[model samples]
Target chain A: MKLRSQTRVILPYLGILAVYALLMAVGVPWLVRRGQLAAAETGAGFNPTSLVIYVVVISVVGLFAGLYVNLRADARQRHALNQLTQATRDLGEGRFKELEIPEDVGPLPETQALKGALESTAREIQYRMEAILKEQSMLSAVLSQMTDGLLIADDNGRVLLLNKMAEKLFMISQEKALGRSVVEVMRHHALVELWEKFRGGESKSITLEMGVNRNFLQVVGIRLDDEIPGRSMLLFQDLTQTHRLEIVRRDFISNISHELRTPMASLKALSETLLDGALEDPPAARRFVVRMDTEVDNLSQLVNELLELSRIESGRTNFDFQRVFPCGLMAKACERMTLQAERMGLSVGQECPDNLPQIFADPARISQVFINLIHNAIKFTPAGGKIQLSAWQDGGFVVFRVADTGVGIAQKDVSRIFERFYKADRARAGGGTGLGLSICKHMVEAHGGKIWAESEEGNGANFFFTIPVAST
Target chain B: MARLTLDRELRLVQDEILILGSLVEQAILNAVDALRRRDIAAAMEVQHNDRRINNKRFAIENRILILLATQSPMAHDLRLLAGMLEVITELERIGDYAKGIAKVCVRLAEEDTLIPIREITTMADKAISMLHRALDAFIAEDEAAARQIPLEDDEVDELYNLVYHKLIQTMINDPQAIDHANQILWVIHNLERTADRVTNICERIVFIHTGELMEMDSEDDESEDEDENLDTA
Candidate 1:
């Protein structure tokens, strides 16, 4: 207040000083010119009445001149001080609004320099702060929306921020997680390891298997220099599905190539043998020829079967389905297997009820499956063994059971019994490009049916199939 | 200009043929592996693949409908598309044949002594060859190859008969052969019929290519099925 008031008082004093200086320059000179006259006029002073009057006038003139000079000096100092005060006010007010000052408060060179500095500094600071704020918010938004989890903690083991993904992965909310202790939300030992690195001011990555299928995710922990003593950022990303699919694709290629190679080799070898002088000996030649023919046939079957399967998988097979009676289907299966059953002396008994409902099925295909099962039953059964085909309605399905008092399937082999090319025993094997039950199961399932088998080693085996009932 | 007909249905039908062809090829390989290695796994795989074939059938059917509705294809294009759908049916049957052979492998694998492995393998090979020829003829529209396939079916028929004869002789020599060998023979027969059907399809191919039907009576030509039963000759 003193500075401001003193500065204000000096401004008007400077105005008075200016006027006094002008008077001094012009009137003083004039007075000097008139000095000889004035001295002559005013020199008459200091006699008691006449002398007292003369002394009073001379002293009064001197006092007025001294006051004017003091006012002029005060005004000059106030002008300098006002410039400083106004410049400070402009700087504080952020003077981008206008770069001008009042005319009465005329700017000095010093005030002009201060105003330029304040505007330039304000602009630089504004640009830098805006850029930094924009980048921070963009990072925050991206982290929050990411699918992978993110965790950032301060040096004191306190949660700083958790994005939405991180919250979902931990099954916690941002509000509940923020400022909470890291140990509270991160219970995994791996995360603890990660957090330990944060404490040690080190960067590391760790993988954890903790998803639906023990899926692995790598968590990378980075120490932030700006964070408090114990802070780090952890990012978790998944890599399981990609890994498994790569293996599956690899296996598929290898398996197909190996499968294709076998038949080709067989064909080449057999044909070479047949061509190599088997013709010289009639009997030997016939056998060689037959073997060669077999190899060729094998190759063709392999190719055809592959085509068939790919076709079915690709949804190119047109199936003709009809509502056919299970009994009739079983009867056809019985007839189909009758000769084999008789040859084996296995008594084949079919117990398909006459009143059994017609099943929505493909008759030819179903009959084919039954024939396959019955054939298998006969093949496994010993002489005089019983092979029975029984069909009955049960719980929205028509069940067909083929049982044989023959060599039963091993429990371990039962699951793969319907797989194509799967042969549990090659020892006393019969002739087959083993694909029957595999095709049967698919055909049955295509009709919305199910097929399975029950068997014990050294006992009997039974194949059961059910066609799902469809209401008319 | 040859004036190629805009047979859109033919395009979809071709897809079905390719799909079915691939499936049958898989089935044949699986069936053969099942036979040679007595592989239950391969058998199950072939069976599983049949579902894909079935699904392909339906998809092809839908595409065919679209083709028929949009293209209004006539004559050859119509025949080819319709034939492709039929071929899928046959390919599915072939898949069943492979399945039957696999099932036999599953069962007879346990037997102490059954039919000769080489013989069954030979029959499967012949049938598969017939299928290959049929597919080739279908794809290339090769009438001569298609017409010639039925003669090859005779060779498969001979093998089928041989399996029957060998099994029967063993059964006659010892009644114990009845149970296992008989079923093996039946499964073998199913595979043999698969070859027969392949020849039948080959004939269809010939008919398609030549625009004339020429059915081969290979079954009658060889007379192997009944002849094997009456081996008095």
Candidate 2:
């Protein structure tokens, strides 16, 4: 039924025709000559035996030729069939090898058409495979380089894909995280809760803390369209630093209000007393006026300190870094605090090692630090208590300590004593504002130094600060 | 066609197990970080996410069951499925230990332990790295690498002992720190148990590769014996 088999029957007939023609040419001539001789001799037309021999020779030749031709055609068909089968299978698997039709086989149109279809199909598939590979690589490139953390999850909360940023933010590896549930990979309950809360189509945004860094991630989850079939995408933006700054800003405002209220209340009370006929008594009027002036001065000092703190914190404080004598700064600080010490009946002394190294600092700010520490020492120390200032070189910096024989800070309060507006003593017994130590900390830090306190309650307090020695 | 689907499903299960392993790894690191920072939020998060790890274990187990029932895999393929079935339990148990550490961190939320957590952190670092390498060996199917992974557990156990002794001394010196130090001791125990689970995973990797379930690392058993001796004394 095949083209090759049909040709097999026809080729044998062609071979038979060739053999018959040869026999006819030779036998007709020979028989004619023989007949002429017989007519001359005994009138015989042709030799029957010669005719039979010619017929037999022709039949044998035709049979062998037909068999050989048919066998060769069958071999060629088999070779072409193998080639076509292999090529088709390879093409289906996205391989594009050329079809190797056998060389001996003639132009078989059906097989040619099959080969053409395969080549074209292979070419089309190859092009599609390349395009898909390129698109996949491009997608992964985008995912890897994205800055914000991104995760795509299925309806069952299983993670389908995550970027490198998401991996880092969640402290998970992408190789291991994909196909796992997002809750397990992220390991943050707030995030899992956030996902659940937003999956219901109500809120799309929620903030949650995740990972070891407690990274505050602002997550927004959106349900993908039905085309993606129950998949959702989440975008995570880190907001830890922003949230901390916001809290700091809020506390700054509240602390400022509390600081201003005390002086305002005192001024109001003093003014009311003066206006309510306390002016008729001359001594009482003078006392009230002095009190009002002091309260006004306290308000002005609070405003100035607040401005200075903000300036230093904002990195806007100008620094004239210069080499200064440690002994001279100590003398200046002690001289400034002498009146306050005497008023409080406390003895103030300085003990600087004469060979102490010079420090690189903003001289005015450094002097302010010393003056503030001494003021605090004098205020907290009882009458006859001693306050000593000392300085010595420790490593790359010159360390200064203001040791006060005052009612010491509690063990717990020592850590927070240097914080802004934090008062160690709850009673309003000290005249100085609580901003002194905090101001000292900011100034010391600006000079590339450090500050801390050491104390045991009811024993003594020592506040230490260090300034880096000037580079030689 | 059935074989192709089986191969794909087997790969998916392998990936899921690695994901489960890394989840527990992250939980351990986060719990330790939270303890060091005194961060209650991170501690609580680790505790809350433990259930998700258990869920993933069940999912992986179900997939393994499905693969076995449908595909009827043999030899190494069978070993891989069975190994995965056992390994997920190890990963889940490790995750629970991490959650326990997180719970201890929450209990010590207010009180600061005088005992230094450095030794425990060192042990955690070793355990995490070991777990990481074990996962790598499992993925690569490297029997040699898997055999070499549990040798690092000796260092983790040593660090655990150091943390234990240091915590005991801290409690002895300051009786007030006894409650806090006891919580820290539990944390160290959790980290030690996590390292033990990593070794178990390594053994599973060897089993998946060779189909012979011989113990790959006997050092952990010896260390446990020694630890028991110390406890009794």
Best by TM-score: 2
- How high is each candidate's TM-score? 0.40, 0.59
- lDDT value for model 1: 0.70
Q: Which DockQ value does candidate 2 get?
A: 0.09
Task: State residue A12's C-alpha deviation in candidate 2, in Å.
Answer: 13
Give me the overall lDDT of model 2: 0.79
Off-target runs (Cα >4 Å) in candidate 1 are A1-258, A341-347, A382-384, A416-435, B1-233
lDDT on C-alpha atoms for all candidate structures: 0.70, 0.79
Native contacts retained by candidate 1: 0.00
**Docking outcome class, model 2:** incorrect
Q: Distance (Å) between predicted and true CA of A247, model 1? A: 4.4
Task: State the lDDT of candidate 1 residue by residue for A1-472, as single tens digits.
Answer: 4456556555655665666566556664555455555567789532244334444554465567668757665575467557556655764665535433333322234444554565576567557767988999999889877878888888766788888877876666898778755655553434665777656867788776542124467788888766554457888786668766875677556655766676678777766776786667889878877876877787676677666666665667777888888888789879877987898788999887788888888888788789878878877888989988898899899999999999898665788888666676755334544666777888788888899999997799989999976577
> How well is each residue in A1-472 modelled by candidate 2, as lDDT tens digits?
4676556547666766776787788876787677677767976555567656766777787677777877876676778878778777776665555534334334455766676676677777888988999999999999888778899998777899999999888667888888776755665545666778767765578876543354677888878756586888889888999988886788778777877888899888988888999999999999999998898898889888988888998999899999988778888878888888888888888888888878888788888999888888777778999999999998999999999999888665788888888886757434666788889999999999999999887777899999999888
lDDT of 1 by residue, B1-233 (tens): 12244543354355346546656655765666676666677777766776776776778777777766767766777676666666777777677666666666677665565456677767766776677657766866778888777777778878778778877887898997688877677667776767767876876776666556665763445354652442211
Off by over 4 Å in 2: A1-124, A165-203, A208-215, A342-358, A379-386, A394-396, A404-418, A424-432, A453-462, B1-233
